[model samples]
Target: MDRRRLLTTAVLGGAAGLVGATALGSLSPEDVWAAEGANAKINPGDPDPNFVEGRVTAVSDAVVFVTSSDGTYHSIRVTTGTSIWKLNPSTLDEVKVGDGLYARGVRMPDNTLAADSLWVNIVNLNAHVDSIGRGHLNLDHHGQRVVAHVEQGRSAAVYNNTPAVSDMSMLQAGKHVKVIGAWHPDTNEITISTVYAAV
Candidate 1:
């Protein structure tokens, strides 16, 4: 198996057995969402928090393991409940293995980082198009290729309302564009929020 597939399987297996009933305990769904939102925004500059800054060491189908500059390693498991979105879709492909990452989550006893949200920092990208398809666009920025999925709508009204691929004609292969969206590592897809041609 390829390295990506192997990593994904290992993490998912660990999460299934270790997470257990902990996610079902005292926190209500609303409480959990609120906590997750709060956790998602925590950063190192904060006065007091449980947030950690690290670099992605490995990305598996179900987990992303990160190591901090201080030499601490964290095993972050992604689940159906995990929220993965990009601040910029056109630039999402800019993230790489050695790139820096900031994550926030409730800590586990084993010192693994059980992140509620994973944010890909895009400050390093020079911005360019990698490839484009009939219903998809691949962006090459920094050292990664971010793929954005687009689908046609039934009518103009429907097309206007659909965020996935509203303006298909505006996107062209090899054209410089910007995108913003979310990433789903489980399926290896990115749901784009917006697509823009580079000025």
Candidate 2:
């Protein structure tokens, strides 16, 4: 198999085994986001009581396109003042093409949404692989220590002598890794997405 297929098999297999049989099916970025939206907690006081949850369809330097659960789409403008998970764009991995997102913001007069905060709590993390082992890896990211689970289906690629796993590998223990998966607030564990090693 090619590198992408191998990595997909490995990550999916690892997630299934680790997360349990209930989570065995493959999760598209949209699928993961949709599930999170169903359970998302919405804070009251917004003008629009009918506010909806959505996933980011696209992101650019200044705007984000959100597709809501009801099949409605909106283009939300992202200002520098917007509250994202990570302050630095380089460290921000919460919102990608396919990610679960909860956006709470104001609706503009033009019918577009102006998001104050875009929560991608359900998205996967991206990180670089600093070290690898038989069934686990240690990732260094954002001044934090993260542990990742490796399984039989997991694959690896070598970039400049550093092993890159799936997006989760971005959490290399001593290197600059970006995490883009879900963050377990209680345990602080992040389910990984993509890991990009600094060039």
Best by lDDT: 1
lDDT of 1: 0.49
Candidates in order: C-alpha RMSD to true structure: 11.3, 17.0
What local lDDT does model 1 show for residue 24? 24
Evaluate residue 196 in candidate 2 and report its C-alpha lDDT on the 0 to 100 scale.
38
lDDT of 1 by residue, 99-120 (tens): 5566555555565555554555
The C-alpha lDDT values of all candidates are: 0.49, 0.48
Query: Candidate 2, residues 1-199: lDDT per residue as tens digits?
Result: 1322322333334322222211222223334344544633555543343243666688876567878777888776544334554212222345677655665445555665554445564444455456765455666555456665443333333345465554333334456544445544445455444343554
Candidate 2, superposed: residue stretches over 4 Å from native: 1-51, 86-94, 121-199
> Highest TM-score, which number?
2
Ten contiguous residues minimizing lDDT sum, candidate 2 = 16-25
Error of 2 at 75 (Å): 1.5
